[model samples]
Every structure is written in structure tokens, then in C-alpha cells.
Target: MTKTQKPLVEDDQVAQYAAEGYFVLEKVIGAEDLELLRGAAQFSIDRLDAAMDAAGVDRIGINAKGKRYFSNMVYQQRPELRRFIFGPIMEQICRRVLGENAFLFWEQYVIKAGDPDTTFAWHQDSGYVHENHTPYLTCWIALDDVTEENGSVYLLPYSRSGIKSYIKHIPIETGDQVCYFGSDPGLPVIVPAGSIVCFSSTVIHRSGANLTDKLRRVYLLQYSPEVIMNGDGTAPHGSYEAFLIDGKVATAVS
Candidate 1:
């Protein structure tokens, strides 16, 4: 990198993540990259809508029509998404937060539908896994200018959450696994489009509904030091794809 160009993820931001459990990289994604991600996000939403229509159901697992949508594992089909996924911006953030070796644990396009309004339950990302594992990293990228009203995520830091470790979550009828029922309200993060919120998997977080007129679109990338397998070792819970190894991007990410 040239003298004028700085690292995508700064050392101070990494320090903030260590202290607060999350850090926001504001307006880091470039215009062209943001456009590509926006297009890809729209495509995933459309596909999910069509799938729900064909299935004659508004809900597919945790994805609810006009409320919430989660289109995951698209890189396996949409090659373009891989460009943004493996780009230097993401790789650098993962390298600092998750250490030298980082495996693709999970990826998804999460949309909070507008009008009707939705409220996600407070829970830790690691709570979803049945087995005990080390805390991973979650990179929540905003595809639109996000605010508290536009379905931005609310984070509870380690100090406020008082959760020393991952706890079992109760699965609600809406398919949300809830861990906290307190009235803390959490910290609302507002940022412009193309910002990234790098947080730990053990952090307790949730998002409110999109009270605005448009859908709140976000892309999520998760990484871990090792392959995350199911509790019984039956199968990988998310993915075991090698992306980063020994503090460098993998030569061939397949």
C-alpha cells in the first residue's frame, strides 16, 4: 500500500472491537463494489420471493415474507458475490478480528421488510450452534443507509449484556432463537450505505423492523478459525471453505 493509502481496517478499529465487542467501519466500501453488492442482494431477494410463491407459503424456515428474508450460501451459485466476499476489505477485517486462519463459516443476505415492521429477538450468533465452539466473527455490511428506523442492528456489549458465555436460546414460534428478555434496548448503530459492522459471534444483538417505506438490505459474512461442524459431527453447520490461512489470503479459495 502507498503512503497515502491506509489499511482498510485500522488498528484503532480493531482495538475498539476488542474493547466494545463491535466496531463500525463507516463508508468503507467503494461505489462500484457497493453497486455490485446491491445488485446481488436484490437478486437474492427476488429468488427468495419466487421460491416462496412456488412453494405456496409465505414463510420458509426463518424467512418470512414481507417481514424478514435470509438468502444464504449464494456464492455457491452466484459467482459475482465471491468477488466482494474475498475482496481485500473483508479479508483484512477478518485477519485482524479472527486471527491468521479464517474459514468461511456462514454468509447470507438479510432483509428486513418494510410496512408491517419486524422485530428480531436478542441472541448471540454462537447460540445457534448446538455444540460449544470458539467465538467467530460476524461482518454485517449495510447495503443501504441504515438507521434505527431502517432496521439497523442493535448490539449489547459484553459489559451491558452480562453474558460471560454463550447460553442456550429458546426457539420461538417465529423461528427466532431468543436469549435475552431485558429492557436494555441495546445500542443502535446508524451508518451510511457501504459501512461494515464487525462484531463477535458471542455478542448479543438483534434488529428491529424496517418502519420505512423501503426494505432494509444487509449482507453478512461470518468466519471462524476452524471448520464449524454440527454438534454430533454429522455435517458442517455452515461452511468449512478455506479462505484465509496463516495471515494471508488463500491462494485458491474453492
Candidate 2:
């Protein structure tokens, strides 16, 4: 797709994302791409488990109801992951929503196994990092058909207006950190495999436990501009490198 071409995201959809802090787009991934991603996810999961075992670290708490298969910076480990992270459609969406110069900040896979008691507390992505970038876009791609019974994500629309105070960071056995905030009844974001749910980093969101037999696998990519400030209002060291997509360097503003 050319830079000037209008991507799949329509004008109304962009408006919705701006107003509600999130939007769902369907059929962004084709069958072949989905199959490839599934394979990559499995590979990442196995590698992560082995690494954790070697380190004698269990990132998932012992009492945690469900398992979280996680890997940070997965694109570097599994080249296939780059297909989704820097894919044409994804780049288009990021450029359209975040701006033409938006760059990828991070990529991860969060697979929630079928566990009835496993639920994520309500929180905002921005809460975890003390970054000056007010808001960036998080593209959550469903690797499987996600439903309410399988721990689909729930988002609170327009919650960015009244930002909540950050609570303590909770460490999980998966070697990942979760930030907690005041709870709220969020709207469930249900989408089929190959679909993407885009939300702002500041949007309040969470996922419930997977009560069904199906697993809920989601690949998340966060995009931001070149700079991110620390909590002390200083530039963070070793700043996150932004990957350019669609010939545009991801930026904080359009």
C-alpha cells in the first residue's frame, strides 16, 4: 500500500477510536498469516518456559489460576513475529491512528490458558511505565477466536479523561509486570481470529479468566514516538528504539 493510499481504517473508525479510546478492526490477518503467527507463538512459549526454568524463576505465581505464556521482544527471537509487528496492514493502522511517523515501541504475546479463576485486574498500559509520552496505540491481535468465556479484553471507553492513580506493580511468574488501578466495569472487546483491537495506552482495560476450554492468545504491539520521558521528567537512558513501518517513523503526534 502506498503512503498516500487510504488504508482499511475508515474516517468514522478513526473518529470512533479517538472518541472511545479504542476500536476493533476485522480480518486484518489472512489465513496463512494466522497459521504462521500461531506457530511463532508456540515457539516463543517453549523458549520462554525453558529460559524461566533455567533461571529457576517462575514468573507466574504458584497460586495463579491460569498460565500466562509471555515473551518480551518476541520479534527478535522469532523472525515470523516481525510479519505481524511490521506488517503492511498493521503499519497502515498505526500510521492512520497514531500518525504517519508512529514507530513500534514493543511487542509481546500474552496467552491466557483456560483457567476459570484467572483474571487480570483493571489497569492502563501507561500505568506500568513512567513515560512522558501521554498516550500511544496498542494493537491487540487475536490469534484465536476470543470470547467473553475465554478471557477477552475489556476496555473502559474515554477513561483517559480522569486518569487513575497508579497502584503498586504486581510481579507475575511469567517474568512480566502488571500495574493495578481502581476497578471499573469495562466493556468487553470481542473479536474473531485475525482481527485487531486498537486502544490507547491510557485506556483502562483488563481481561477476565478463561472459563472455556479454548485458549485466548493475543499478540500486542505498542507504538510511540521517538522520545519518552521518565517519571522524574528526565529523558530515560537507553531510549526505546522505534522501528519504522510504512516508510514513516512513528511519532508521538500526527
Candidate 3:
């Protein structure tokens, strides 16, 4: 698929994101690109399984029932996946939400099989990382049609304020420094395949158990400004190297 030539994000959408802490873009990815992404995700899953077998260890996030939670996906090795990660339309949205020069901080592939107990606890993405950098943006791309039955993510609208103090560290299979905030603040986000839901890293969000027989797949990508630098001039523990997009740093415009 061809890249979008013009900016996909509008002024009203930016206003909505700032006010609600989240916004949805329907059909942001076309059919062709969506298929390509799905293929890349499958490739990543296969690679993960192979790597685990070679190391003689079970996958860190995979369960015996076939559920999977993989991070730092195929964007590094697959050219097709990198196109969507650094695509023009996504860059436009990131620039509008983050800054003129936002960079790709991290990416992950989250999949929930047809398991009734698969759920992600309520937590903020910012809580999983250092507190020094400004809150970043998380763009969740739905690779499958997401609904309440398939474990769609639930997010709190306008919940960024007073959220930091509520963060509490919790142990999970994903990481030792994982955190949680116990509260159902918002409704589930239901969108179709190829839809993109962008929200603040500080916003409290979680996914429910997958009750449907189909799998729920989502590509969770993050973008941050150059302000992520620490006071001691070092990157945060979970923060990845930023890929400069528009040759400008994040400014205080929003």
C-alpha cells in the first residue's frame, strides 16, 4: 500500500486526544498493509517459539494453553513491519500528539488466545518505565476486529491527572517492575481491524479475558520525544533508542 501523502490527524482530533487522553482512527491502515502486518506478526511469533526451543526454555510470556505476549517485535528485522512502524501517517499522528519530532520508543505484539482467563491487569504504560521522561504516546493497532468478547482494551478518558500516585509495583510474567492500579475507570474500546487507538502512557488501561474462539491480536507501538533523557544523561530502563521522525524535538505545544 502507498503511504499517506497528507497528515491524517486533524485539529479536532488533537483536541479530543488532549481532553480525553485517547482517540481512535478507523481504517488508518488499508487492507494490504494490514495483511502485511499480520504476516509479520506471525513471523515474529514463529521466531519467538524457535528461539525459545533453541534456548531450552519456555517462552517468557507464552502459556501452556497457547496464549502469547511478545514485545520488541519484527520491526527490527522485517522491512515490511518497519514500514508501518515508521509510516508517514503514523508519524503525522505521533507528531501531532507528541511533538514535531517524536521517535519510535518501543513496539510489542500482544495476543490472547481463546482462553477465558486471559486478561491484563489494570495498569499504566508509564508505570512500567522510569518516571523521568514525559509521558509518551501508545498507538494500539488492531490487527483483528476487536470487541468485548475478544479482550478489547479498556481505557479511562481524561484520567491522566492524579494517576502517578496510584501506581503500585506488581510482579508479572512480563517483567519484574510491572505495576498495577486497581480501578475500572473507563469503558472498553471496540474498533475494527486496521483501526488505531492512540492514548497517553499515563492513562490506566487493561484488557479483559478472551471469551471468543478467535484470537485477539494487537500491535502496541510507542513514541516519545527527546525529553526522555534522564537528569544524569542516561536513557531509562525500559526506554529504547528513539528514531527521530521530523528532525525536531518535542515542544510544549499541546
Candidate 4:
């Protein structure tokens, strides 16, 4: 909590979240925390690259070597990331949006290489679940300036996308699970580094190729008011760790 930090959420943004299913928290990350995130992202990327090399494969699941990598639970590895994860800004955002005791759902680094091939498919965060599950909140934090040409995100609200609820996605050979195939040309998100673009888990969104010469670095964090369960009631869908209780960040991290 620096003096420069603005009010975490606004009335209009909350209203917009209810209506449009998404909102942007502009430049909310402090400079020091932003650098920590960048460092952690690079650290995770290097580790992923090493794992891929050891396995002797250029591609692992959806992670393409030198193209795109999805590194999960990155905060668990870096102490700085742990501080940022349990810090005030994220707690406030989760409390405001979820409106209940918030649980850590999933956190990851989605790093797209410079000028890679066609990237993420048009899909909802819930679409990945592909089964009945509670919709959670996704906070996509930009580690670098994001723009249309540089493979920033594009979102289609539930009202516009027409696929309002969670739907099963079709798997492709390219490793994308796609749900929406229409040509509506989703709304492009253009924002500077340190901004967080928050959206509902059911909101349809995707990103295109990074045509620029720089990597498009995004760290995504998801939170839910309740601990979501996996399909068939097997187990919790996420880490099921309590981040906030009674609208306050838990003193002891689980």
C-alpha cells in the first residue's frame, strides 16, 4: 500500500462488472511489486524452458517452446510474488468483486513470445472447466504495456458474446479449447503495464499473435467467494486456499 495507490475499486467499475462482466483496474501495481512480478515471470519461464528441454520436446500440452508458456502457481515459488499475492491491493479487489470470503483459485504466468503464431482461442475461463462449476473472477495483470498489435487480450461480454453461461469447448490439434467461433471481433484491451483487467470466469476472451518484437507478459490471478469443486465432485477445482476471510486478508497463508 503506497501513497500513490488509488481507491482499489470504484462504484462505476462495480456497476460495470455487474452489467458488462468485466472492468479494468488501471496502473494499480506499485513499481517495486511490478518489478518483482517481472522477475518471477522470467524465472518461471526459464524453468519451464528447462523442463521442456529435459523432456526433449519443443511442445508440452499447450505450452509451445519459444511461442507461449502457461506457468501455474508461480507465486508459490517466489517470496516476492507471495507478498504481492497476499498484499492489500489483491485483497481489496477480491473483496469488492466477489463480495464474500475470497479463496485463491488459480494464478499463472501466460507469456507469449515475440511475434508468435495465432494464440489463445476464444473461450471463457469457465470453458476450460467444461463442466458445471461456479464462475470465478480472473484478474489479468499486465507485466508490460499491452496493445492490439502486441497480442493483448480481447474480450466479449456475456451480453454481446451470446454464450452467456459456461459451455463445453471443442479441443483442437493446436491445443486450444475453443467455444466461440463467431466473427464478432472481440473488444481489444489496450492498457499500460501494471494495470489489471478483471473479468468474470464466464466472460469470453482471447488474444491474438504478438506481432511486435517484445514478449507479451501477463500474470493472471483468479479468485472465488467459495471454494469451487471439480466436476464429478471429486475435489476442489483450485488450490482451495483462503486468501481473505470476513473481507480481510488472512494473516496466515494456508
Candidate 5:
């Protein structure tokens, strides 16, 4: 019943992730497990759209001059998500890539489709965390097979070493703008279903368009040291605020 009693990480995974900033675990979730998580993601997506509509959240514009963000803390609002989030597969991987002391930051569905370039801009995870520490990892789980044809995530080789110079906001339109972590052309990361990949928050990364007929469904679970604090406990800029699954409001890590 103690922390050390929990399962430990494999040496290979730890070594690989440390050197490359990522490691892919194949078939981490079986079909049943994948289905459960997918169901929650689908339902959450629907409920989110509805909630936004009811709030008169314009499909394109902001309601109060503030930007929009989405994240689900499965341990709270979506217990079903716990099956995927804290599964032995993820727990061990996180404990290895991050440390055993790591905990959730937030989770998001980076759903994308064809022709709508709205691909995530290149940016490091730490750019949002604004923290000066380790364990700020982004675990990307693919719900379906990912391939270059449909816009898999792209990573700039060893970009984490240049974290500060790469994380910057650039204007995409007149006045309206967004952020990019780096400008270097990146290599696309394609993995099979049920596999997971981990990256440091400071690693430059982004996704491409979903050009194929299939939807590029991805679950982004971000985590960091459970005890780390970022400025009076507020969400890092560019990340979504989340609520716990039990309907309790989530506070910042601080």
C-alpha cells in the first residue's frame, strides 16, 4: 500500500526515453481498453460542443475576448478515462519517462481532420507549463493508427535543448495571434494504435493535417511533478483549465 509497492518501470523504456525524449510502447491498451477511452472522448466532445453552444460560444469567435481551451481530468469528470490514464501501461511509462512522483497536469483530445489546417502549431509542452523543472511530459496516445498520410505528430530533433528560443507567439492574422515553439521543419511521428509516445514539455512538437479519409484521433495527457507550483497555482498560459472527475473544481498544483 505504499508508493514503492507500486509497479516499477522497465530499464529499457527509461533509458530510451531519456536519450530521445520519446519512447513508443506498443499495444499498451487492448481493444476493450481503447474502446472505453474512445467512448469517453467521443461523449466528452459532444457534451463540450453542446455546452459551448448553450453558453453562446460562437463557433468561431470568443465570447468575452478570451481564448478557448479544452482538457479532461479523467480522475474527476470522466472516471472511464481512468482506465486509460492510469492503466499499468501508462503508469509505468510515466514513472519511467517522468519520475515516480509525477502526476497529471491535464489531458486533451487533439482531434483533427482534412483540409482544415488548424494543425497544432509547433510548441514545447513546458512553454505552457512555465516551470523550470523535469517531469513535464506529454504522453500522446493514438486511438487509431497514425501515419504521415493523415498528419501524425512531428518532432524537431533534440529541440528541447533550445527551449527558450523556440517558444514564442506569432501573429497569424491582424491582431489575432497564436504561439509556435520552433520553426525548424520537423519529422512526423507515426505509431500504431494502442501505442504511446512521451515527450518533454520543452521539446518542439506539432501535428499535421488529417489528410486521409480516417480521423486522426489523439489523446494528449500532460503531466509533471505533483508538487511543482507555477505562480500561485494557475494554469500555464496556452493550456486548458480542468476539473476533477467527482465534480470538484480543480485547483492549480501550487
Candidate 6:
């Protein structure tokens, strides 16, 4: 199918994303690609579990005690991950959403399996690192079908601008505990596999309880302009580092 004829996002979707802070595109990624991502995510999860076992870290949720991450640096952990995250199809959507020449900054995976109590507290991603910088856009790719019964994402419509006023601090053992930035109770956005939900980082969003028997897998990819800074008045480093420059791996700092 041609690029235009292929199942692609519409202008109204983009408008909704900008105004509502999040938009779900139906069947954007095909089944073959979804299987590939599923395999890659499983491998990454296994490796993370092995590493945690070796380190003796508990796989706890953000709200509960013990180590809350099953895996943090999957992009660096698996080179194959870049094949999906940086795929041409995803790039096309990103370009349209953030304008041409949008650079992918980082990626994170949230894997909650079984009866884990590690709930993801409500908070803006920008608050996790840079609280002062623009959060730009985020693409949440689901490897498995996610429903409200399986810990789907909830977001506030049109609450991105008012998020700053609702910022409140809450302490958790995960070292990253913070209340939701926006108080508005927007509609819950539930998407299935082979689909992607895109949202602004400044948007108020949170993952709900995983009530289903199966696992709930999600990949969070954040993109922004080539130039990036921490929102908390700090410099970008480590995972938040800008890696995509001019739509290519940046080899030089200049």
C-alpha cells in the first residue's frame, strides 16, 4: 500500500493529541511487526529478571516497597529494540506530530507481570527528571492487548496546560514517588496490540491496576527537538541524553 493509502493517522488525530494531550491510532503497526516487538520485549524482560536475581533486587512496583523496576534501560540493554523504536513507520508518525526533524530522546519499558503490587503512581514523565523543560511527545507501544482490566493508561483530556498547578510531592520507596500533576479526571484510553497511543509528556497520565491474569507490556518512547534540558533546572545526562540528531545517531556534540 502507498504511504497515503496505508492505515495512517489523520489530522484530527493530531489535533486531538495536541489538545487532549493524548491520541490513540488504531492498527498503525501490523501483526508481523507486533510479533517482532513481542519477542524483543520478552527477551529484555528475561534479562532484567536475571540481572535482578543476581543483584538480589526485589521487583516491586512504585507504590510498594523494594526495587520497582523490572527493567529500566532496555534501549541500551538490547540493540534489536532500536529496530522497532526507530522504525520508519514510527518515525513518520513522529515527524507529523512534532513537525519534521523530531529527535528521539529516550525509551522506557513498563512490564508488570503476575500479582505484582508495583503500581505506577500518577505523575508526569517530565517530573521524573527535568521538571522545567518541555516534555515534547511520547509514543506508548503496547506489545500485548491492554484493557482497563489489564492496567491500561488513563489520561486527562486538555489538562496538559494545567498540569503545573497540580504538582504535589509524595514519597515512595521506589525513589520516584510523586502525585499526579493534573487533577482533572480525563477519560481512560485503552488500546489493543499492534496499536500505538501518542501523548505529550506534560500531559497528566497514569497506568491503572493490572487485574487480568496475563502480563501487561508497554514501551514508552520519548522524542523532542535535538536540543534538550532537564525540567528540574539541571542538564540532561545518562538516559535522558539526546541521541537522535538530524534524524541520525549523533556522532558529534557540536
Assess the local accuracy of residue 233 in candidate 3 as a C-alpha lDDT between 0 and 100.
59
TM-score per candidate, in order?
0.94, 0.80, 0.82, 0.94, 0.73, 0.80
Please give, for residues 1-254, the per-residue lDDT of candidate 4 as tens digits: 56886668988998898888999988989899899889988887898899899999988888888989899988777756777777778888887898858888899999998756748898889977747777899999999999888898999986797665788789888788888889898999999999999999989999988888888899988988888888878899867888888866674633
For model 1, the stretches where C-alpha displacement exceeds 4 angstroms are 251-254
Stretches off by above 4 angstroms in model 2 are 1-6, 60-66, 159-183, 229-241, 245-254
In model 3, what lDDT does residue 193 have?
A: 97
For residues 166-219, what per-residue lDDT tens digits would candidate 5 score against the true structure? 354454432223455335667777789887777766666776666776556778
Runs with alpha carbons beyond 4 Å of true place in candidate 6: 1-7, 59-70, 159-161, 164-169, 174-176, 181-186, 230-235, 238-254
Candidate 5 displacement at residue 49 in angstroms: 1.5
37: Cα error in model 2, Å: 1.4
Local error of candidate 4 at residue 147 (angstroms): 0.9
Position 110, candidate 2: lDDT: 79
Compared to the true structure, candidate 1 yields what TM-score? 0.94
Cα error, candidate 6, residue 215 (Å): 0.9
Better of 1 and 2 by lDDT: 1
1-254: candidate 2 lDDT, tens digit per residue: 67897668888889988777788898778998888778777666777778777777756432232366656677677776666666677767866787745666767777877776567766678766754455778889899998888998988777543643333456665433565445566788888999999888877788888887766788888877544567776654223656564556433221
Encode model 1's per-residue lDDT on 21-101: one tens digit a residue: 888899999999898888877778888889999999998888887778899997777877778788788788878888889
Instruction: Estimate the TM-score for candidate 6.
Output: 0.80
Error of 6 at 138 (Å): 1.0
Per-residue lDDT tens digits for candidate 6, residues 53-111, read: 77676543442212223455576656666666667676667666776456667676677
What is the Cα-based lDDT of residue 189 in candidate 3? 91
Query: Candidate 5 lDDT (Cα, whole model)?
Result: 0.59
Better of 2 and 4 by lDDT: 4
Query: Which of the two, 2 or 6, has more lDDT?
Result: 2
Model 5 reaches what TM-score against the true structure?
A: 0.73
Q: Whole-model Cα lDDT per candidate?
A: 0.86, 0.71, 0.72, 0.86, 0.59, 0.65
